[model samples]
Target: MTTFLQLHLLTAYPPSNPNRDDQGRPKQATVGGAPRLRLSSQSIKRALRVSEPFRQGLAGHMGQRTKLMAKVLLDRLLAGGMDAAQARTKAEEIAKVFGKIEPQDKKRPEAVQGTTLAFISPDERAFALDLADKALAGEALPTDKELARTVLRTADGAVDIAMFGRMLADNPDFNRDAAVQISHAITTHRAQAEDDYFTAVDDLQRREDTGGAHLGEHGFGSGVYYLYACVNCDLLVENLGGDKELAARGLRSLVRAIATATPSGKQNSHAHHPRAGYVRAEIGGAAPRDLTGAFFTPVRGDDLFDASARALERTAADIDRAYGPAADAVETMDVPKGQGTLAAIEDFAASALERQNA
Candidate 1:
């Protein structure tokens, strides 16, 4: 059975759009008969994947999530001393091995593209690039190219691809199930959507020209939010070609990323990026739980941070009482002023992996 790593986080933001809706307002949902600020799994994962801590830590061990697979391979072929026309033909042929490529068009016939976004890693692009080089040399093509199962094995080296997984509709065999599951962050207390009305004064305008150059209103809200994530160690290892050591490193980096990173949605206008006020890291039964249940009644205390922490403790105790205990190893951290140290959190996460490996 796979060991599961679950992280429970409580963070507070002050009037920021960590995640926004199509209308350019903070995303929200009605919960417990009251509106709660929302942050999608996509935004949360993207933030974590691109976080400086993740980049600095994983450095060369990550993947680029884009549709530039074709372009990437084409560039590599040209650098290998191939002529332009031969490089383009071989590149598209190899690109077709990954996903359906749009036919060459008059607008930009030389450059090919996938039908949609393909979360290909640099390693995968390099692998395809080698294939194109072989095709140029008139070598035999890979018989397995027709089946994506053989072409999509580059997940072994890409941290983001292995953790978040990939989906290729053109070939389901290449799909790698996500080892990590991140939930939408929901506000602990009910909140009302607030507005900020401001105008940009034109730098070139004379004093008598106009009152303001441009005027507009934007939506925002402030609240303490609960975020949850679970990492399946076995699946993570499997995604990385059964490299337990690398997977452990990934989990360690991911914990630091979660503890430090905040979504960069409207930070320029509303710089409200704050880390988790409270964190609960646990290596529990496969059945994972989130403390969103604790806010069912909506915490009503002068100190929402401490109140949220207490509710989490109480709810966790209640679960153990009713469900015969869930955690094998558990640790808690609270930064009431949003200044929690992550040293213990990182050590705790790595210890879980070590224990599982043991």
Candidate 2:
């Protein structure tokens, strides 16, 4: 039986633009017939992957997502004393194993980059570099197929790649399906972005200077946001090549990152780093379901966080009443009430791996 782990979080931000739209204003979504500040799943997942907790916990088991694979390989080959022309050609050949190469710019003819970003695991990166060294040493270059087969991996010990998955347009067989699904966080209550206008004074201004050196305006919003995520535990383990221990550790790190990590939009201007006020974790063989419906009507109260928490609980209870229990086990960490600790939540989520193994 396939097991699923679901997490719901309520976090409040104060006067910050953690995510922005094309206009450089805070992203917004219409929910329950009202506008609400929004945070994209892409931004949230990036934040989680780069979070300190994930870095410390996963360490070497992380991957790099970039279009500069060719550039990196070219630099390494050149540094190894290979001819520049030969290095660029070798780098481009190896890079094509991952994705299509971008056309060389006339101004920066030596620079090489992929047309699309490729998520390269550390092991895969090392393999590519090793291949480059072999070629530099006069070894016959392998075909693109051979290079990809030797360099590409489903996960390659990269927990982030295993969790978030990656797609290789040229080599679809090497692509891994995402084991986790994240929802765009939306404010539980109707909220609109407000503009903040300010001026920066010239540090070396003469006494005669009356006006400021620079002026700008940016948008920010404050509200309690409800976020949802579901993990296919079975797929996660499979993606990790059945390394249950690593999967368990990954779950713990993921929980911590989800709870503590905030999107890095305009943090320098508005340091709105707030932890999740409430968290609910569930694991079971039953099909996964998100509790986004809880805020379909949009929560309202003097204490928005408290009200949002209660609404989430109420929604879960209502769902249970309607469809029976959706999870065999559930754990929560309510920061405001001090009812549970993050450590306890982490243990609870990781315990699913044990159950699966048994």
Candidate 3:
């Protein structure tokens, strides 16, 4: 039986556009026939991957998502005294191991990027760069499949790639399945984006100038958001090449990041940095299920955070009653009630790996 770790969080943000839509406004979703602010799973995962906790904890075991592999290789080769023409040719060969090379941009002819962004592990990046150095030294390198086999990896100490997975369209065999699944966070209560209009004064304005320098308006919203995530502990360990110790560390870092990280959308202007007010962590062999149904009818009360927490607890109990217990054990950190601490939750989630071994 596959063991699973599930996390549910309630965080309150005050008038900030953490995630925006194409119109540059806070993203919104209709739930229970009411509009609510939303934070996309993509945005949440990115925030967690880049959070200080993840960076500090995982350090060298992280991957970078970028399209500049070819450009970076080309620059390195040229700096190593390789001819520019030869460098470009060799760089394209190595870069194609990851993805298709993009057409040279007319505006920036020197920039050579991939058609699609590639998620590359640090080890893979170093390997590609080493190949570039070898080419500069006039070494005859392997071609095509041989080159890709040397450069690509199924799992190469990249915690983020192991958790979120990656797809190499050109080399499907090198793809990895995600071990962690995240849901788009949505407000527990009905909320709508409100426009914030303001004018900025010019610092060097003349005394005679009466009008402001610039005028703009953007959308913002305030509410308690409920976020859900599930981690396949078995798959996580497998993705990390069966390194249980690294898997435990990744889980701990992930929990901390999810509790503290906020999407960086207009954060400078709003400064909306709020930690999760409540977090529930569960571990078990039972199939994973989300508690989003708790807020099917938008929660409403004077203390929105408290009310939302109650709704989540009540929903979990009701579900257990209906379907027998879904989790073997559970831990929670409730700021309002002061029930548990984040450290306890982290330990509880990591214990899943140990339980699986038993």
lDDT digits (tens) for residues 133-182 of candidate 1 = 67667776665444244456745778888899888776677788998999
Cα lDDT listed for each candidate: 0.80, 0.92, 0.94
Q: Which scores better on TM-score, 1 or 2?
A: 2
Best by lDDT: 3
Score candidate 2 by lDDT.
0.92
Of 2 and 3, the candidate ranking higher by lDDT: 3
Q: What is the lDDT of residue 187 in candidate 3?
A: 98
How badly does each model clash, as a count of residue pairs? 0, 0, 0
Residue pairs with backbone overlap in model 1 = none
For candidate 3, the C-alpha RMSD (Å) to the true structure equals 1.3
User: With candidate 3 superimposed using the best TM-score fit, by how many Å does residue 31's alpha carbon deviate from the native?
Assistant: 0.6
Off by over 4 Å in 3: 204-209
Q: Which digits, one per residue and each the tens of the lDDT, describe model 3 over residues 121-171?
A: 999999999999889889977878889888988876899999999999999
Give the backbone clash total of model 3.
0
Model 2 alpha-carbon drift over 4 Å, by segment? 206-209
**Model 1 lDDT on a 0 to 1 scale:** 0.80
Model 1: how far is 256 from its true place, Å?
0.9
Q: After superposition, how far is residue 59 of candidate 2 from its true place, in Å?
A: 0.5
